[model samples]
Target: MALPITDHIVAAVSKMVDDSQVEGYREPSHSDIEFYVSRAGLTDADPKAQGQTVGKAKRVRAILSWAIDNDQTAGGKLVESLIAKVRASGGFRDSSANFIGADVIARAVEAFDSEGYILSSDGALRPKNLESLMGRELTVALRDYARRAQKGSEDAALLSGTSKDLLEATAAHVIRTKYGSYPQQANFPALLGQAFIALEMATPEDPPSSTESPYRVMERGMYQSAVGVNRLRNKEGSGHGRPWVASLGVVEAEAAIELAGVIAGYMLDKLDNR
Candidate 1:
């Protein structure tokens, strides 16, 4: 099945190309078209001759359409790369036409924003669907942290800190849903345990005998993983005056974030069922 490449995204790219022609700005060259097509892992299905500018735009559209029809993940990546390229080039503006680029970027941002994603300050595309599962305040906070954590150039300290904050906000949201508020005085692991208990999931606090069930064991393991995440956060994460740990890297930070997300999602699932 074709992936859901929204019309808004497709139109944004096509419009940018078309608009670039008005100002006589450089359009994507033949090699550029070939590169993008190959990048998306798509074969050019439309080869009809047309005006230079319009032809390039049409070829881009054709390539993107073919990508959507054939490859799900690559299609999204292709769109993201195109948007990033335009954004990096400061929009589709000529030397005398500053507004063009801004206009194109705004349209692209709006298109992606509508699809539960955000264009970060550096123009990186990141997921922003926490609103469906959390309050606006928490969702915004988590989204910001997640974006920073996921950025290609983020430092290990920031990634570690943001990953920890993501879990903390998630736990707070789950706890707030069950009770009226979260315990501000609780430690990270304790707060995580409270969130699990609030959702009636197995926490480390559960008796050893009761944790023997496979599901319970898995939940307990999740709780332990969260604790480990907290430990990493304390040792290497930001928000402290501690010295930077050279050993912590992107891979470890990403793993921590993914683990936190998994545990948070599991707890939220329980909260939803309740």
Candidate 2:
């Protein structure tokens, strides 16, 4: 069977980055597709690829694309971390000569996410239907490494997939501008010179944000045990940073980013009225 959708995205991104290099481009370190590979499968190469020097990173992206097409509920960094572990293990052992590399296992994880949680008792990054967008991105990022590897090479196949995706995205955007009603935000992340500084707990030593925002308690406490007063401190303590949150595509955690935005907006409206 083909891989999932998240994997496909990874493949496309990887290709894009790979092809970019041929244009005498120097992509940023974080932008390098390889940074995402360990999560989207495609760890080691097969006997043919191993010796023949096929791009392992490209293969990883290919596998990742397969996963994305098949799965959407998956997302976030936690799951990415798990896929990373599997890739580090040198792929999985199979009964037949056809070894199930990180790519194959990643596909399985998508299925597991689609079905429900697929973790072992040890809580390792096994299958789980509790899809998280964070996990999905994590997968895409890893799978893309393969494309990066290809772009690094002089092969025609390098970045072939990525070029197609960019063209598609551009075309789609044009069409949307001409026909669509709901317009996209001109600035996607923070606009202009805005920067996002990260803050978090200091582990066993520091404990500042344990009760900062009573509002967060109402927001994250659902589908979770950490609610009420506990959420407040952390909310304010993070120096007003966007608090770390989880996704729900993993069949667990219940947070619609858009919905959250809507609610916040409504509250803001009410405050203004008052």
Predicted structure with the largest TM-score when compared to the true one: 1
Residues forming the 10-long window of minimal summed lDDT in candidate 1: 152-161
Candidate-wise lDDT, in order: 0.60, 0.30
* lDDT of each residue in 91-184, candidate 2, tens digit only: 3344322223344455554444554433221113322221232223323322232232223211111112232111112222222323442123
Candidate 1 per-residue lDDT over residues 26-120, each given as its tens digit = 44445655566566666444343223334657766765666556665777766766655655555544453423455666887798778766564
Give the Å error, residue 218, model 2.
Answer: 18
Q: Judging by lDDT against the true structure, name the best candidate.
A: 1
Give the C-alpha miss distance for residue 161 in model 2, angstroms.
29
Q: Compute the lDDT of residue 27 as modeled in candidate 1.
A: 43
How do the predictions measure up, each by TM-score? 0.46, 0.22
